[model samples]
Target chain A: MKTKKIATYGLLVSLAFILSYLESLFPIPIPIPGIKIGVANLVVMIALYGFGSTQAFVLSIIRIILVGFTFGNLSTMMYSLAGGLLSCLLMILFKKLKFFSMVGVSIIGGISHNIGQILMAILILESASIINYLPALLITGTITGTLIGIIGGLIEKRLKKFLVNY
Target chain B: MIKKNDFILIGIILAIVLLIWSLSFFKINWPMNFFMKTEGSKVRITVDGQEYKILDLDKDTTFSIEQENGKFNTFEIRDGYVDMIDASCPDKICVHQKEIHYDHETIVCLPNKVVLEIIDGQVNEVDSVAN
Candidate 1:
């Protein structure tokens, strides 16, 4: 059982890495910076629902660090760390509450992710005016988070049986 | 399947975003008619939170900025307008942005951490007061 868990997590990490790579391939160009679909969150969400918070957190960190080294700079790593950690935290909290389904949780995650990134932006730029981008970032977050939630829900439904045995 | 509450949440988020976006237009000291009358004769450039250079819009000239890592951005000040004509950043979003000459308007290149903001007059007293 222990070995199975390790193997499964490793596979999930690779899946997330691949998803991140795929997202960079065809970026949706909006006029704003730090905006993307963040498809890797789908894998993280799946890990959360399947194996709980510990597994989800592990996968999130590993994916961010590995991807940051492979395709990003120091600033990118910092932004990703801030956004990913906050997003994951919110996802776990919402999931525990059980008031909302996967979709709603994902939306919350997305919103918090943007908030986290903007916080980092404010700190790095040392300008409060950077907060002006909040509304736009939140809107983009909502749209992308909703999409990720829907996709995660479908994936979870299909893998439910296998996940239970694992 | 999405629930009724989910739709409500979406509506709330959309409404909030729209509210903030619309509110920005009415900010005090920001002339509603930006194009009709423009102020601010100086542009402040900063990189990675450090002041790089300041330029007077009254003088028309072109200059290039090369960063420590060999990345660069080129700017042109013509007819009292500042425009980023070229940049080494891959996205080129900064290069494609339109020129600016209004107070508080900013052009930001995220990858390069470069910011160009316009301020009114010789001194930024209003900005200090607001802050």
Candidate 2:
């Protein structure tokens, strides 16, 4: 990657980090656990569609870490890490499978992140009882993920007019 | 076509969220837990997938459950609470949760694959009599 490209990616990552933190400050009307209107993810979904899977993955992780550090809440870091990794992985995999469109990838990413985090919570708690919470998380994930993805796809379609080739 | 798909995705996500929220919100009654622990020589329990029950009593016995390698983790009961003490997984979030004893409380350790809860059971004879 060229230095200029690296700088651009870094900017993208920073921008995403800021957005994620900002979204955290936004109150999600839904009271469901793990439900969020993560506006930062909109950028990530766009990057994945316009750029490449690898770049998007890097962006997601950087955002999570940056948000985690800024908030100084090391405890919830694992949840973020697990969710981010799973979402990115699923998005890329689905993209390779020709799964619908960028919006679809974002939905998959959102749902997978929730599933991954629940799995993380289940494993940590040594209790399957909480599995009942899945339906709620998945539901919220789908809604938020799809919304972000659609926004991303729109942005990507517009950005395609530029000289960027993923 | 992409626009239509986006609408469908959005609709699906919204439907799910609504369904889940309604179910969670209107849940009139909580479910019961079958694995209730009693005071005995051995406190056998499962954590994450490993089964570790403690013998030789302590101040306040707390059980932490975790799972590892498709097996339930056996946690150590210490300090009137439970801790992973040892595990094979890379993350140990369950071990960090504070001990819980209330009927509705639960301790979740994600890495170890354990979910320790105060299983609902009939109160003991003495407590039952008191009640």
Candidate 3:
């Protein structure tokens, strides 16, 4: 790998880690567990669009591990890992299909992330009733995903010129 | 940069949201209520999926549990409603959740592995009339 690629990887991973830490500091007012704006995903989305799936996947895994150890426990790590992996895979697939724009892909990412976490929660808690939170989670995920996608789209447009050199 | 397919995707999601929202809403409000007049008479508490205690909602009281792992949760039943009053969990999302009085409603403290659910208490006059 080129030095520039390595540096980009480091930069994106650290940015994602910092974003996760910052997000944990400010809890969303919603009472639902595992609900967040997913600001860190913005970094992953950018990496996926700018670089490729492999880079995005690596960045996501490293960031999740770092954030999980720093701000959360083993169970929390499991939840994050599940959500991150599902969201990254789905986003990559959607991007490849070329049917939807970044906004649409991000929306799918957000909703799937919530679904993935909720499924993990159900498994850990052994309660099917916890699925009651699905509607609210879906709505919030859609809204936040749209916001992140718009911002990411703008950033990618500007970064495209510089990224080509690397 | 929003494409036509983006709108289509969002529309499909919204349709799903509406379908689910209405189904759950009507399940609680229309058919069940119209048939039997079900009311939540007992609050069932569980920890780690095991039954902990079932408290009568009619008697206003406070209950607290402290696990060996140092996780703790406290709740109160007042005026036929159950409310999570305190917890050792960092988020305390359960405490902030709205108090529940209807059957099938729940307050969950995920960090503490605690769940409080409103269980159907009595079959009222509606059931007899229908029968």
Q: Give candidate 1 misplaced runs (Cα > 4 Å).
A: B27-43, B56-112, B117-131
In model 2, where do residues sit more than 4 Å from their true spots?
Answer: A29-33, A163-166, B3-131
lDDT of 3 at B33: 31
lDDT of 1 by residue, A31-61 (tens): 3445778899999999999889989998999
Answer with 1 or 3, whichever has the higher lDDT.
3
TM-score (all chains, Cα) for each model = 0.76, 0.60, 0.76
Give the number of colliding residue pairs in candidate 2. Answer: 35
In the range A63-162, model 2's lDDT, one tens digit per residue, is 8888888874865678778877888888888888874677677778888888877777655555555665566677767777767876776777788876
Model 3 Cα lDDT, one tens digit per residue, B1-131: 99998888888888988876687565543222335445689998999889998989999998998898788999999998899999988767678766777776688887678999889656544467889
Question: What are the clash counts of all predictions, listed in order?
Answer: 0, 35, 0
Error of 3 at B120 (Å): 13
User: lDDT score, residue B43, model 2?
Assistant: 36
